[model samples]
Target: MAETIFADRVLIGGRIQKDVLIEIDDGRIGEIRINTSGNSSAFRVPSSCLVIPGFVDIHCHGFGPDSFGAGFASARRATLAHRARGTTSLVAGLVSSDTEDTSRAIASLATLTGEGIIDGVFLEGPFISVARRGAHREGFVRPVDLGLLSHWLEQSKGTIRMVTLAPELSGALDAIRFLVREGVVAAIGHTDATYEETRSAIDAGASVATHLGNGMPSLFARQPGPLLALMESPKVSCELIADGRHVHPCLVRYFVNHAISGVPIFVSDCLGVEGEGKHIALVSDRLVEMDDGAVVFKDNGKLAGTALPLSGILKSSVTKAGIDLITAVSAATIGPARTIGLEDRGKIETGYRADLVLLNGTSLDVARVMRCGNWVVEKHEYE
Candidate 1:
């Protein structure tokens, strides 16, 4: 076994302590033990920085440097960029489009999965409400049909991790139940669902509320929508886009404190246009132009996607969301890991893969990223 030791003023299992040592052999965590003898020379540490577990993101469509919505090579390129940014495991999210195009994206992702890059694929729509379609193409937004979905699932060869649907739509509740029975995660989003409909969906085995507050209607003083209804579901975990543009900072703070009983996974909700420089993005065949960080469709004044990075989300989660670094990082890491049923990663512990990030100071800016014990990206190396 190839042996190595890493130590730091470590945060272990959510606590900060000194001289924490992690032993690694063959890229797996061999053992984790603390040295209380006040002796610094016992274990070899590569650096004095804090080490966090590999981050897992369940809902990033693509990274800034690459565009996946256009084709397969772009998706693979985006996946590589995301890995460099501390996303050790990710679900390649695809927006609703023509069935043929969607099939092609799935097929491309299936190829990547065979090569061990993506954990699985997440189909975000095609069964969402037309009223709350957001940036997705309305032409592609249709009611759920179990037969069609099962066929698509079959085409992917059982690699679909999650699917987002509106519960009140035709065939949605049954689809939710079917997905649950098959061990696939069903997420509720892009909906105009009433409280009763949202509750019914949860009861039917929908477990995730995708980008909870952004894609669905907000709470009313009397008639609460899917967002508040999801808050009431004990079985459902909420997905939050910590990107400051998608949600208000105060509301994010409130949700972090109150809305979720379980870990709230932070999703980027990023589009392919991101990190590719300023350009008009086509949403639903409508052109959306970005100006000074805001995306707007000139034709209708509708907001498109944000050009925000996960690092930006982490910073805002601390400064704007009133959350500490550890809690926010947990939301970004272990929360998503548990959401997708990934058993082995997302925590700094023994027997875990050494996918880690070294951030500078308290800012959470990724100065270096190591995936599976390989230094895939280093800041100074680039500088």
Candidate 2:
């Protein structure tokens, strides 16, 4: 049996330790020991690099300039661009559109999911409320119907991991129930729902509040809305955009401090304009700009997707926002992976696929990225 050794500082659980030796055999971790004093040939990680597990973006829509709803080929190309950013596993999210348009989007994602590029799909609307629709098209926003949701789920062939909807509308509770029955994650978002209504949705199997505090009513003194309800719920997980545009820094801190600890995930909520140099992405055929470090629609009046890459999200949280590095990375990695039930690829542990990213200890630049043991990105030279 041929074996190779990787000697470096490893970030396991939540701590980093030096002189960690991980032995690999047949592309699987054979053993891991901390300076066991053996003659194991060692390959050092570039100095000042920390090896962590690959990122899991549970709610990124598309990559490059192409939207997932555009076409399968376009989505595939977009996702490959996403992987180059160190997102080894990700859920392709969709915005609200007409039923026919959504149907086509789901069909296209089904093809990419079958090919294993997209792990699953998350449909974020078309059943949301117009009051809090944000950028979702008003024409397509409607009440949640289980039959319709089931149709879309069936079309995806069990690859639909999550759906975001307004929980106060007619048949919303039933839709939540049906989605849970079918093993789909039901997320509440884009609504004017009151605390009671949001609580009822959580009781009815809704487990997430999409981009909590964004896409919903703010917590008022008189009426603590969906945001407050989700923060108080023991059964719910929440999502944050953390890009500094979608939310304020204090609110992000409050969310990290209060809401279900170790449960909420960070989503890019990233619209289609990931890479493509200021090209305004189209939402419902309207031009949206990827400009000035944020994705803006119509010249800074409306917030579209984020130009915030995942790496930048982590760095900003730690460096700019004063968040603990491990906690911030967890929100981006383990939290999303578990939220979507992808147990195979989140943490740096044995028996998990070695999909990982190496980062600069201080600057947070991506030092290297690996997918299934292949060097997809390398920032340092190794002989």
Candidate 3:
């Protein structure tokens, strides 16, 4: 059956188009009619609501392994939780852990990605700095082991899309080169690298700054650490956690506006426990709990992860971080989709996958989500 949706304003091709009519044919966008004369027969978006593409989150946890316990069922639960709330695309995030456990998790998540439950896998580290590890287990931290990296890649069978590592680690530049050649995103994070080291890594094909402003050294005027280097490089995609706590709002504005040359991708970095997935000792097997609105480690009080889902992050990105709606929406949607080479399913354009989200214009609450042209029924009806 064919279906049509009408909205006063719909986000398409990175801008809002007025009075648009989107026709869905066989789960794909068919004809997008702009300046439609108010099709009352079509499913109409509320006047106060904004219709945008479903969100794409490149950095997040709660599936497969590392602290939150193991099992594919748990990973499905995490993916479903995010999908129900409008994050139609997600990259399963894993923290530093034993090679055996990490490989097992990667295999499971690769299966999940194969099944189209999640987008892909992101290994936060087994190759990060111990001092800058933050919530990661220090025992699992080590210098870049090219052999281990190659093993994981072979085990993942192409599901591993992103890997975070420190440039200061031994053989990191070589590993970055290998990852780039293999079509994987080499992300810079959890590092104690200097500006020069970061530049070297970037030049060596490290194309992403994972969760920038966190898991790395602070930016100093005299020192000008990795943060400056990552921001200055034109080839890097900077990942910013948008729960309004990971990076200062002022810094968020600067980064979204002038600090970065590449796309500023907003992420949740939530631990995959439904609401406020916090106060839990599941991240990298490090003892942690929720302090205030943020998740922190129990021993040293460093940030472990976030409790907010991508919905909360989107709301905060606009209301708290002072980022424009279009820019924030792009960060959450197309920017992330384009970063990892997902050419489809992130925008409301012609011939794209009909995945979309409708939100309250003022409050920014997710009113409803439509994945592949089907509206999501709430749990109340499911049960």
Ranking by lDDT: 3, 2, 1
Clashes of 2: 0
lDDT of 3 by residue, 1-383 (tens): 78999899898887789999999988888899998775667998888989999999888886212222265888877777777788988888887888888888888898988998888899999899988988777788977889999999999899899999999988999999999999999999999999999999999999899999998889888989999999988899999997778998889999999889887999888774332333454445456676544677676777776866677788888888899998999999888999888898678988888889998889998888988778876442111
User: Number of the top candidate by TM-score?
Assistant: 3
Better of 1 and 3 by lDDT: 3
Relative to the true structure, how large is the alpha-carbon lDDT of every model?
A: 0.76, 0.77, 0.84
State candidate 1's TM-score: 0.91
Residue pairs with backbone overlap in model 1: none
lDDT of 1 by residue, 28-88 (tens): 7766778643344344444545667777878877755455555778888778777776778
Number of clashes in every candidate structure? 0, 0, 1
Cα lDDT tens digits, model 2, 96-145, are 88788889989989988998888989999888988888878788887776
| TM-score, per-candidate, Cα-based | 0.91, 0.92, 0.93
Best by lDDT: 3
Runs in model 1 with CA error above 4 Å? 36-48, 274-276, 279-284, 289-301, 378-383
